[model samples]
Target: MTASHELRLITLYAICARLFFITLIVSASLLPPFDSSHKTILPAADPRSLFDVFVGSLLRWDEFYFADASRNGYQYEHEWAFFPGPSWARRLVRSVWSTGGRRTISSLSEALFTGALTNCLTVWSARILYLISVECTGSASVARISALLSLLPSSPAVIFHVGYTEPLFNLCSYMGMLNCMNAKWAQASFYFMLANSFRSNGVLLAGFFLWGLIADPFLRKQKIPLLNCLKSILYAAITIAPFVYHQFTAWVTFCQDDGLSVEWCKRFPPLIYSHVQATYWNVGFLRYWTPSQIPNFLICSPPLLLLFWSSTDVISRLFRSHTQSGLAKQASMVLPHMVPHAIHAFVLTSWILVAAHTQIILRLASSMPFLYWSAARLILEQPKLGAWWVGWSVTWGCISSILWAVFLPPA
Candidate 1:
């Protein structure tokens, strides 16, 4: 009906769905964790009461580091793997919450605070994603469908987890993308800067600045003004400044005097993020291609395939002379504005497939609106596959939530 009504509906749906997911996830704690050691993963994971299931159990996986960062500043070298943005948000919220700052997030008050913060971020992120989808597709119906699909994201566990980056990162990324679609370059840059502070790959968001300012104009053979060129340079620099500064901070921490003992410090440029990833997480080109990891790859295929196909669909439309009906018609209506996002999806999908942790695409892909939009396209034009995708999202989302609560694999 009306925009306000639509927003109200979205907010209500998000809240209901999130609560439902949280209910199932927390209830799953009745089952013992996959590993006995999970009891010690977080002090809160000790089966004391329902509060532990609801809040404490969420502090699994990378969240341990985040809880540490929020409670205590980055204390270890590997802690740099997590950007401080989400932790900073947690700190700000916890501070204003005016309680539970005495120790680690094991306290019930702190755990509740974490859930509230992440839930708010996620619900609002869905709202912003709807706005961005409408801007991109030029149809509220498409936007509505996409936003609903976003609610069934591939990793509800991680997205809803306490102290996880997905919630904050998705919100900032969508806000920035929405601003970009509205031609608000400054707003977009500021949000992009925030997104970069949460995830290192957020540097890739500079594509929007580059495409809007330089690449898109060049592709269309439109004359770019000198002022525009200067603005593009400035905006791009601003967008990537967080990532660059993150690297700089790492250098200062580990390189200046820590070099003699650290192998990564001696390397030219000395980026500790890369070193930490490769050394600690075994992240590199083809490194995860072993037999033991095939299941992980299988686990991550749907989003990666969606990203790959959707990105190619957009690029192919750019080259095709006409659009076909039904599925092709729905997919081939390429808005020039969407090109940069498609390119981003393609590049990121490629990177994750070969180099980064493939399984992360579940949660990582959530930050990209393109995935949801693509899923919407399938629902409209290719119902069978879309149904499968929806099934996968819901089934996997519930399972992963329990897996996360129990400190299971696919971390």
Candidate 2:
């Protein structure tokens, strides 16, 4: 079959899988959320109309933070922890959809619209993932499998459909990688900038692209002008400048309010997000050594191990390809293009070990494209297991979704 035909098939499969997953996600909202007697959890939006079932279900957990940030800027210090991209995107959408009126859109309406909008973007993101897999492996079947793998409703799966930053971040990240693969460095830099603005992980993603530009002969061999290179650098620098601004903001805010000296404020910077996380969220580097953190790590290890294995192969091939001549060198670079996934997975794992909550690893793992790619490679190698894999994955997704809907441990 032609590549276009194969791509069409993959697109159709992705659409169907997304519809199925979304249906379950919306339906799951009908099930009552687990009682939160002791935990200081945010209250979910009340499902007033039919639309609530679709959007209301996703307003739990960190959704509140994003919603609050969007409605009221970074009024509270803890609110700065959010990157603001997702919330800003939602506010933009709400503004465009709103008719001229004195009253602003209700927070409920804003949250609902944000959830629906992000979820729709996720469908397109899956299409991009399929395209990337096809570009890398040149196997339509692998592409299909990779796209299907994205449908699994892991613990943080709801984040994609909610007001959280993951959907926007994931979309921009995938687009950046796609542009990078096509050697559209400026475009890739732009998307990466947006991705970086959405989440702190974008910094690591920028580094990953830098690695590609430096290590890949194909990229370096391009006879680009100095001006273009400088442009790329400018875009990248602007992307990272936000974090620096946040740090500066923290210092100014603290010094003005606490009556501290400029010198003392410089030491604090604007790392209030980090401080809040450490003090309130109990997050610190290498902080997951406690017995309670064991389950979170164990549950997420399978995908992380797969990611590590995939990354190791890339690192090995990166070296091996350097020694080869002609086409062999190019082929080796193809595998190493996936090295970013490994780096992302590594960062998340390291964060889990040292600083953040262990459960977050589950959500973060969904960002690793190699996890899906590696799964596709395994299933395609043993074609007989394909159906079984789908069945098991869907079954697991259903159980996890149910548990997550009830606010229970799902990893």
Candidate 3:
């Protein structure tokens, strides 16, 4: 790397390190006392809390399982209801603690490990954004801008501190993308599958991987033979099989218990329309509520609205350029690669719309690392102004996130 590139990497790493420390502090503050109330600090109970509950229940599975069943039926176990595949991993984690009467230490250690995993993932996601920006723009400065923007306080606060799957899912998504770019189909498929296991929408990475494969220039020179194609297909299937099996099991269980169809549409109706209306209402102008909630609303709305506008502008520009560029040209280039990202944004938006839940924002924030790079590349032809705009936006976003973290209620 050149001197400038090294400098950019160092600067971005420093910013990420700062954000990581901040996230750790915030997350530590939010940890519940060992014997305090069962209620969580955050507005909605998320995977983190559920993970904690699962660990606690492992100490007395029979009693806790039946009690939870009596109280909330299957709903109480919904979060831990991973399919047969992850059950072994869960058991292994439990086994580590069951060896000694160190349950408390085990629980705390689990929480800390999860938090650290999330922090590392967010940092890796930022690094991927930096790499993509450097590739697209061929400028160390632009890459640094993308990396710094991704490390802005909002993204880290949401991912590391908020106790969501966003960080892990984002890391896996980017790993899949990176492996695909390097033509490592098997590794790409594995990370993509892991991402899917983390979150339902993570299958989007497969679309990204396919786009990367089709767009690769090497494929033109060395024609994809039948064996290669078969290998790729097998890799993709192996990556997807676990998630499919998990879904199938869930569907069977739902049908057996509820006596109803278990189609994806029935399970999640809004998936059909891309959940556009719901996405808009939840994260857009409609997010503002009554005066009592205005402070919280104001704190959350700016980054969300900015992200919405940025995504909209991207879509609008694509549509406007379609006729001039031609569908085939665009499809083989940036457009198709970007489609998976757009789908990710849409899915995240839909979740926000339906749930109006706070943690969802952090989940969607994972996509911003990629989106920010795209935004920088799109506008950076104007160099000076583009740099200023990106810098200012990042500065404001960081300030907003810090203030929000300082003042906002726990979780």
Query: Model 1, residue 334: displacement in angstroms?
Result: 1.9
lDDT tens digits, residue span 284-315, model 3: 34353445655554555544654566556555
TM-score for candidate 2? 0.83
How do all the candidates rank in terms of lDDT, highest first? Answer: 1, 2, 3
Q: Which 10-residue window in model 3 sums to the lowest lDDT?
A: 57-66
**Candidate 2 residue 260 C-alpha distance from true site, Å:** 3.5
What's model 2's overall lDDT? Answer: 0.66
lDDT tens readout by residue for model 1, 103-192: 433345665677787888788988898888878888899889888888899775555657677887888899989888878999999988
lDDT string for model 2 (215-239, tens) is 4445446555556556556656765
Using TM-score as the measure, which candidate wins? Answer: 1
Per-residue error (Å), model 3, residue 171: 1.1
- The RMSD (Cα, Å) of candidate 2 is 4.1
Better by lDDT, candidate 2 or 1: 1
Sort by TM-score, best first: 1, 2, 3
Q: What is the lDDT for 238 in model 1? A: 88
Report the number of backbone clashes for model 1: 0
RMSD of each: 3.4, 4.1, 8.6
Model 3 Cα shift for residue 129 (angstroms): 2.9
